[model samples]
Target: MRSWLLKSLYVLAALRYPRIRPDLRYFVRDNYFARLNQLRFWRADFLTKTPYKVVEFYGEFDQEIRYAMPFAYWHFLNGTLKQTVASKNTRPFYFFSPDHVEKYEKRVWEAGYGNYSIPNMTHAPTYDFSKWARVPFKSHYQNDVFVYDKPLLVIANKYNIEWDKPPINFLDIPALDRLISGLKSRYQIVYNRPLGGQIVHDNSEIMDLGEHAWLRTTHPEVLLMNDLFDQHAATVQNFNHLQLLVYANCNHFISMHGGTAALASCFGGTNILLSHPGGGFEHEFNEYNNLFPNLSGATILHAKSREEVFTLVEGRF
Candidate 1:
């Protein structure tokens, strides 16, 4: 009868539309709530150093101060948009205070490079000087501030962040061993991690990764990577800043910037780009609109993917 028909429809609907899983619901809710905690922690950290209302309108202070270009660039430029764009492998031009610019140029000479490249494209912040200028170490020259002494090199283990891929720890002993084996020169490298706290001492100086103790190697001292996320659990928002800080402290930084040659320019340090032929830079996430200076003195030769990383070092040294 009518009741039976209604029941049949109801059963069919129930069968077709299953209830959301409790675990998934919890995961979503947990992340939502966790984000709030994360925001509170980030705000507290900034407030401790700066005024409370500095980031009041942004809700989360960290996100407002540290931005991802394209979407955030407008906000960063205070709603001013620039028309500059990269055309088929052009280098980016950047301007610092005259004093900082002199120091910046000198570092480039010491690093023995002209232009640095980082991956980039349409949506990225068209300019990210603020993000580039702030070094984690107290010593980095900001704007007009300049430090010319021998600096420490800070490297972030961002290579393992491929979406849908496994999270590989650079501090993992076996992996470091393999990575070291591929290297010829002894470049001092400190691997930075996200610990969700203030970055303290370098972890590579202490961690005992047997056989992977490439740190023992005098020339290329390899440091262990620490999880900055775990340490700063509330404040550190992204790993890119960690890399920027490292670059600020170190004599020079070598990175693929997730394979974006354009990001290297805005980052304000020496960079080596790994170019992939015919890949058309298609895989790169260029939302940051990082400007690449087209000047020859500003850029180095691009390395095709066919070239091994070790080989590049051999020639550089």
Candidate 2:
């Protein structure tokens, strides 16, 4: 967008949503322009001129789930999605009916709205899903082999580089200990921190938290995702598929920020996300209360601090 036009849009956004922070107001501007841009395709979609509309994206996993995936799902529901494209290991995510996702690209997601071409996709996910259909991940992936004695609680943690810096919005050993110690008896706890190369890398470098050995020694009862992967290696297609199976059966999750939380929120449950670095847009736009829930009616509780994680775990979880 031109600088002057961008300024004018920002002004319009501020006038529209005067109470929100400046960041979100600009997001509103971006979304409005993005919607305007989508008008170009109306003729094709309305006329059914194309046999199918192919939507392709290889962006950051978080943004993909937050914006792109849902946008594509809307097209699929409306009988227009012919094929979807993304980076490797995302077949499980797009495994809705007539699932056709070709994962052959490598594109690091920019912080900017690089996926504006996706119909209904914006920097911040919209609250309404009237045009969206929740992907039935649980129905497709749920299995009796993954059943547990008690209700499942998936603890999806990640220690990855954030914003060219060291790990942020991750659960350290102490926080893990507290979560396990507190919720051990009530639910079947599953600990997950996908090692480097296990999934697609999107600019963020996966750093070792060195908590796996500690979890084994300190809390042997908790099921480690790595261990589960090995145990069910013969049965599951890949790590992402394993997650879909396990998380499909789970109703409670304690996930770190970004993609980890995004995946967990796909299932209808309560996900307590640990985002220590100010909660980002998830807080700024109240996505936790609105957009996140739109995924599968999951209650996304954003904990801006580790202390608040415990508080939310005790009270909400």
Candidate 3:
């Protein structure tokens, strides 16, 4: 019935916006079908019974890096604990979408959960457990780390888009160049780009930001310094796991305020979050504190300007 209703809404939207029907179709698929699958699995947890504890994560499939990785890992830690404390005969079973199941199967299994699965309408109920879980930061699954040989500094920047209000939480090309130049002598710097199409706005018009926008739309020369500096377009090349691995091993991380920053937080290193005070999202810092309250060898700083960022990075290194 719900699927029928959503399909009806999609049809209505298609008829109403005939000119951009293709975009509307994608919008419906992402917003409706994806979210509906999450809801179905979440609801199934309540009706099913298992010998072991069950934890359900349902929502926000679109931003896998920001929402899925950190949130799912948190639950995976909790599910492992619940199973261990309950009984050796029973083990926790985690339910996630098949896409996630395929991508993160090894990591989920290593976190100590008994089983992870994709659910359907007829699936039995599993326990609905709630309570945020925290675990030590370590490279649990992928043991092979990318050794930079030299001191490594990972930089994540946002361009051609505005994610925050007022001052805007982005570094201009010149500012970024200065930051990179200042550290080039001391560390090997690598730029990490977000994995997905960015939004480009021209006056009142908006459209998808092309994949090569970073290389073509911007001054490519600014990024292509010498062998000392490198750029990794993770999203354009679909290098999600590789990006995570690099973040896991980097000596330091500097990122704009966004999902990538959140994922970096999980790695537990010297992290500097460049944020705009006008954005009014200061609570994110406190939330991260709670999530990673016991992280050792980790220092997190919030910087708003080039000088502050440089100073923070210098102080850390």
Question: Using TM-score as the measure, which candidate wins?
Answer: 2
Better of 2 and 3 by TM-score: 2
Runs in model 3 with CA error above 4 Å?
1-71, 74-130, 135-137, 141-145, 163-167, 195-237, 283-297
For each candidate, give its TM-score against the true structure.
Answer: 0.36, 0.90, 0.51
Cα shift from native, residue 15, model 1 (Å): 51
lDDT of each: 0.32, 0.78, 0.44
Predicted structure 2, TM vs. truth:
0.90
Q: Lowest lDDT 10-mer window, candidate 2?
A: 122-131
How many pairs of residues collide in model 3? Answer: 4
Lowest lDDT 10-mer window, candidate 1? 99-108
The residue-by-residue lDDT of candidate 1 on 80-182, one tens digit each, is 2222222111111111111111111111111111111111111121333422222122233232222223343333333333233343223344434444554
Q: Which model is ahead, 1 or 3, in terms of TM-score?
A: 3
Full ranking by lDDT: 2, 3, 1
Tell me the tens digit of each residue's lDDT in model 3 across 173-262: 566666766776677666665432222112211223332345334434322211222333432222443454466667587877654455
Compared with the true structure, what per-residue lDDT tens digits does model 2 show for residues 263-312?
A: 89999878988877554566766677767777788888888888998999
